[model samples]
Target: MPKLHALELVPDEAGQELVRRDWQALRDAGLPSQLDHRSPTNAPHVTVVSAPELPEAAVDVARTRLGSLLPVRARASGVLLLGGDRVTIARALDLDDDVVRRALAVRVQVPDRQHVGWLPHVTLARRVDRSSVQLALDVLGHRDEVLTLTELRRWDPDLGAVTWLAGH
Candidate 1:
């Protein structure tokens, strides 16, 4: 099976703590955790860019070019509502100049934010009640956080297999 291409960010200590707290709070507040809660499966990462429906060749190209761009620090600002009650409380990401230029270079033919306006976020919870929005917000509060991104890791979402985009 084919897998989507994503950039995995290695979170700093503070970022890690924030995610941990958020995960626990969401569970306590009667919501299920997102995928990353299983440490063995996924790491906490801001989706630098995601493009759907690409050929195998493009993915191979992405894997090659991702390392060309130096690692960037992605900061989180506020909460993003992914329709219904699916919400992600986030720390902000300041897409650096090096990151910007290379993100474009590495951009595939996906008709979305892969080209512009990439929203970087750490998901707090997913698929909770609309009535529980405030509860989720209350748990997250107004947290200003900074996550330093190092390398982009290509992952097989279906199989939960990952390869580090380190050396070209």
Candidate 2:
């Protein structure tokens, strides 16, 4: 299937540093895809909305309407287990509920996505074993950091590309 347009939060200094730190921890623990920012999928981000496909016009409109919300204070906790055994291990992040609403208001173009009650997070590892999860917890303990989200990003999953939308 062709990739859809996905909107995401691009983190600032603190967040990026956190990602780098986390990546190193994972690498030290002999995990896969660590410090692999060269791959878009491995890049640090928190996706806001994803659709099968999106129009260029809608993206531009969203840029204009949601531009001011940039530089959001993104907060994340240390370790969060998102699924059952061999599930996704992630760090929890939160975007404002209202902002999420506006993003979904445009989701009519793309269906099969549940925008409400969304739990925003940055996946540290996916389908990891129990031992790996413990290693991650041991490496990265419970911590809090503020991520200054200066811009929203448009991600193309199939192409592994990201387009940054300007914000002030």
Candidate 3:
């Protein structure tokens, strides 16, 4: 099996912490949540692109491609439920922002279905049951929050490392 490498945009501390709080809320409510993933590499982020395998030079290429688009101000509009069989609860990021869309457009094309288009979300939970949708929503109320995207990162699952690419 090939290692999965994801190119993503990460928000500042405030934004990350807010997502963390949401995860904690869901977990405390005994619901499926990202808090279950205790890996050091796991955190709140918007995936720009993902592939089973990417060249070693991908970092540099991404940096050059998306460097100037940093510090993008985006909105975490509200809660989102994605997927067909198993639902995923997430905080929806605003794609209407041209800067956010342009930055995400630097994604490397991959053949995976999930990578076909970007919805720009910070996942809160996965495999949430239909019965628990309302409960999850209640736990995490409407979030009309702004997030300042400050960095681009490469999350290499094989190496379990998050390498900083651009921004402070």
Q: Highest lDDT, which number?
A: 3
Residue 153 displacement in candidate 3 (angstroms): 0.7
As for TM-score, the candidate ahead, 1 or 2, is 2
Which lDDT values do the candidates have, in the order given?
Answer: 0.60, 0.68, 0.80
lDDT of 2 by residue, 1-168 (tens): 546668776777678778778767877788643464466455677766676776776576567655556767767855677667676667887667766665555454445443544567777767677667777787777888666667777877767677877552
Q: Candidate 1: where is the Cα deviation over 4 Å?
A: 1-5, 35-39, 51-70, 85-89, 109-117
Better of 1 and 2 by lDDT: 2
For each of the candidates, give the backbone clash count. 8, 0, 0
**Winner by TM-score:** 3
lDDT of 3 by residue, 49-99 (tens): 778865555556567766666777778998889887779999988854665
Regarding TM-score, does 1 or 3 come out ahead?
3
TM-score of each: 0.72, 0.79, 0.88
All predictions: root-mean-square deviation over Cα? 3.9, 2.9, 2.2
State the lDDT of candidate 1 residue by residue for 1-168, as single tens digits: 334556545565566666777777777777666643664845566665665443454445555665554355666667766655455454456666766655555555344324466555677666666777777778778766666565566655655667676632
Worst 10 residues of 3 by lDDT: 105-114
As a TM-score, model 1 comes out at 0.72
lDDT rank, highest first? 3, 2, 1
Give the poorly placed runs of model 3, Cα more than 4 Å off.
Answer: 56-58, 95-97, 108-113
